[model samples]
Structure formats: structure tokens, C-alpha cells
Target: MLVLVICLIIFMTFVMEVGSIAFKLTGVEPSNARFQALSALTGTGFTTKDADIITKSKTRKKIAMILMVIGHIGLTVIVVFAVNLPQLISSWQLIIGTILCIVTYLFARNRVFVDKLDNQIESQLVKKLHFKKEPIEEVLLINDEYKVAEVRLETECSLINKSLASLHLTSKGILVLAVKGEDRVILTPKGKDIIRKGDTLTVYGKIKNIEEILCK
Candidate 1:
């Protein structure tokens, strides 16, 4: 029972990690992706407006479904094992489980190990799933007042054909981090660069300011 419980815990950790990676590949931020993955796996009701990110994306929805299913089954098995734990209590089993749990925790906490494992898993997932490697428009909230977001310009938008210098985005307290054009990306785009339709702009500023200046 002890061994089964320990193995289940480790398996749950792995599933969470995989879920995080899957969310990330679908353009979710790293920290939020991990949190959402864990929340879904544990059946925790940690909903926020960000939950819409998963619901709106078909890939993310599928990933969440898988995590929830596996989480339910895994939790059920763990509960069954835990119920029998008192009856089958043995000093050796307890000691071994403790050592194994500690080892697993250490392994999970090791940055180098986790990074390598994540990289390998990410690579395989991308290859098998044909996930897009390009940058996707992801918005990240820095705090209550500020946010970083990617705004994609449309053909009919007034911003198109305008140069960054003419727009004076700096005066508006908005910083353009990068400009992803149809063919390539420009990091720290120069003021002279023209805004073309279908171009994605990564910008940072106050949440309200960003919405007013770019999202419109």
C-alpha cells in the first residue's frame, strides 16, 4: 500500500508537469500554465478570467479534459490505497515510503533535472503533436495595474501604415517590446518601423492603457 501510494504521488507530479507543458505550447504563460495544470489535475476550483484561455482553445480544452480524467482515476486509486494503509501498517513500509517520497521531492525540486526532463518531454510532445513553435499572442498580468500583451493589427485598423515614431507610443506609457511581422520578428522595434496589417505587437503598459491604445 505504501509503495502504491508513493508511486501514485510521483505519477501525479509527472502528469502535472506534462499538463503544464501542454498548456505552454498552447501559448499560456509559464507560471499560470503550471498553476492551471495543477488546479485541473487536483480538481481544485481555481477559476479566474484566465480560465477562459483554456476554454477558448480546443487544444487546451482537450488537455484539461485528459488531466481531469487521469486526476480522478489517480485520486480514486490513492484514496483506496490510503484507506488500506492503516490495516497494513509496517515499520519497513513506512520507512521505505518516507525515503522514496523524500527522494522524489528532491528530484522534482532539482532545477537542472526538472529542466532537462521538461525539455525532453516538450520536444517529444511537439514532434508528435505538431505543435506550433512560433510565438503566439499571450497576455500576462504583471500586477493589478499593469500587463504585457500581444496585439495583432487588422487590415482595417487605423494603426496600420503608421510608423512607430508618428504614433508616439512612449508618450502614452506603452513600450513596444517586439514586432512580429508576417515573415520575421523585430525585437525593440525602431521608431521608423511601419505598422503593417496582420503584424503582432508585444507591448507593456498599464492594463487600461494597453486596452485603450492597442486592443481597440
Candidate 2:
């Protein structure tokens, strides 16, 4: 809906230019007007065949810069690209608009996708378990400074048969805040509760020490 509204605004602005807004706004220089309109619509920085002539006025130059930036970022080049690409088959304005839109969107979307992927990888690591303990195996999860971390309970481990009170994890500065099982996370286990094999323990503590407890 937001994209549609913005694209509509751009289309309307383009249509309105046919009625002399170009000449009224920028005088007799048709090329400058065309450049400004294209910059405003696509957010591109390219100047016309006669850029030297338009650059004489400092005030007009500044205005051009402001409109260019607003057209590119505020109006959103990505949404414009997505909108104009399919419409270009029948209209030349849409064809030029779509080309510019695709270029801008590609640049922006790459950054967005990288950030999202980083977050997803972090989330998965925080919820992962260590099946067989090894120094190299410990490197898979994020460092221990992170408050939320996961550790897998092995069947032969001493804590497996003992009650929650018996292990005394707090003595080592670690806290087992939750136990993640097949279907749910147990935040508070009773004193007599015994950990089972394959249980994913969510621990909170210093990173180095957390690794120690998981490997021990």
C-alpha cells in the first residue's frame, strides 16, 4: 500500500509536468527541467547534455541536490523499481523509470538482505546445541558474553541424573535459565527435576565460563 501510494505520487508528478510545471519551475531550459524531473523521480545523479549551463546558479544547484536526495531515498528507489519493471512493456516512461528503479533497488536490497541474514544466523546459534564436546565444536555458537546461549545435555553427564539443586551451577557464575526440549522451553525447573539427554540448556553467563561449563 505504501509503495503504491508513492508510485502513484511519482506518476502524478510526471503527468503534471506536461501542463507547463517544468517551464514555470525552471525557465526556458527544457533539458534542466527534464534532468530535475528524472532526478526527482529516480533519485539518479546524472545531469543533462548541458549541465554546465544549469550549474551557473548556486541556489538552483542546491535545490537540485535536495530534490535529488529526496527522490532517491525518501521516495524509495526499490519500491519504484519493483513497481515500474512490469509496466515498462507498453510505456517508454515506465521503461526508463524501471531501469533506474532496478539499479537503485539492487543497491539498497543487498544491504538489507545482509543485515537480515546476520540476525538469522545469530538467532540460530543462540538456540543450537553441542552434541559431542570438542574445542572446535564450541566455536559454532556465538561467544559467551551474550546473555542468551544454548548447551546440550549429554546422557552420561553428571548433571543428567542429579536434581537441579545438586549441580549448583551458580557456584561457577553460570545460570541455567531455561531447558529447551522438543516442544517448549522450561524457564524454571523444580529442585528435584533431573535433566534428560538431548535437552537443550539455555544458559546465561560470561562467555568464557559458559564454554567451560558446556565442555566440562
Candidate 3:
């Protein structure tokens, strides 16, 4: 029973990681993607707006479905094993489980380890799934004062053909983190980088300022 419990925990962790990466590949922000993946897996905390994001994307919807199914089965098994724990309780098993749990927790908390694992899993998923790599604009509220978002430039956008230096976005307290062109991504885009139509810009700033400048 103890072994089964440990196995289930590991499986669920892997599944959640996969789900998070899958959501990200579908264009969801990293933090939001992880939150949504956890919500779907545990069958909780699905706000109407958040749930709509999942339901609207076919790829995300499929990933959510898989996570939900696996989560239900895994949780059910865990419950059954938990109920039978008293009958099989042993001091040695308890000690071992505790030690294993601590080790797992430490490994998970290690940023380097987590990054390596995430990269490997993401690589495997990309190879197997061949997820569509379209540029998508996603806006997320960070707090009462700040916001972070991806704004896609359109043909009619006023910012098109203008360079970042000319727009003076930084003067308005807006920072452009990256510019996603059709073929590649430019991190920390320079002042000379021009905004082209269909390019996606990841920006961060105060809520009102971002809305005024980029939301249009």
C-alpha cells in the first residue's frame, strides 16, 4: 500500500508537469498554464473565464480531458489505498515513506533539477505531438496594479512600421520583453527593432498604462 501511494504521487506529479507544458505549447502563459493544469487535474478552482480558455482551444481541451481522467483514476486509487493503510501499517514502512517523501520534496524544490526535467519533457512532447506553433496574444492580470500580456500587431495597428525607440514605450513605463515573429523570437527587443504586422509582443506594465498603450 505504501509503495502504491508513492507511485501514485510520482505519476500525478509527472502528469501535471506534462499538462502544464502542453498548455504552454498551446500559447498559455507559463504561470497561468500551470494553474490551469493543476485546476483541471484536481477538479477544482475553474473560474468561468479560465475554464473558457481551456474549452476554447482544441489542444488544451484534449490535454485537460486526459489529465482529468488520469486524475480521477489516480485519486480513486489513492483513496482506496489510504483506507486500507491501518491494516498494513508498519513502522519501517512509515519511516521509508517519510524519507522518500522528503527526498522527493527536496528534488522538486531544486530549481536546476526542475528546469532540466521540464526541458527534457518538453522536448519529448514537442517531438511526439508536433504542436502548432502559431503566435497568440494572451493577457493576464498580475496584480491590482500590474499586468503582463502578449499583443499581436495587425495590419491596421498604429505601431506597425514604427521602431520601439520612436514609440517610446519605456517612457510610458511599459517594457517589451520579447517579440515573436513568425519564424523566431527576439528577447529584449532593441530600440531599433521595428514592429511588423502579425508579430506578437510580450509586454509588462501597470494595468491602466498597458490597456491604454497595448490593448487597443
TM-score winner = 3
Angstrom error of the Cα, residue 162, model 3: value is 12
- Misplaced by over 4 Å in model 3 are 138-163, 166-216
Per-candidate TM equals 0.67, 0.33, 0.68
Please list the residue runs of candidate 1 whose C-alpha ends up more than 4 Å from where it truly belongs after superposition. Answer: 138-201, 204-216
- Candidate 2 displacement at residue 103 in angstroms: 48
Q: How do the residues 1-216 of candidate 2 rate in per-residue lDDT, one tens digit apiece? A: 334444555544533243122222323233345555555445555556334433654434654565556555645654655566565444655565576567646754687764574445434433462112222112123453645555666556556667777878778777777776666668896667777766667677767776666656
Q: List, residue by residue over 101-178, the lDDT tens digit for candidate 3.
A: 898899999999999998888888888878754335346768889877786665767888999999999999999999
In model 2, which runs have C-alpha deviations exceeding 4 angstroms?
A: 1-146
lDDT of each: 0.84, 0.52, 0.83
Model 1, 67-136: lDDT tens digits are 9999999999999999999999799988989999899989988999999999999999999988754234
Candidate 3: residue 100 lDDT (0-100): 81
Each candidate: how many clashes? 0, 1, 0
Given candidate 1, what's the lDDT at residue 18?
93
Best-to-worst order by TM-score is: 3, 1, 2
Error of 2 at 205 (Å): 0.8
* Arranged by lDDT, best first: 1, 3, 2
Error of 3 at 145 (Å): 30
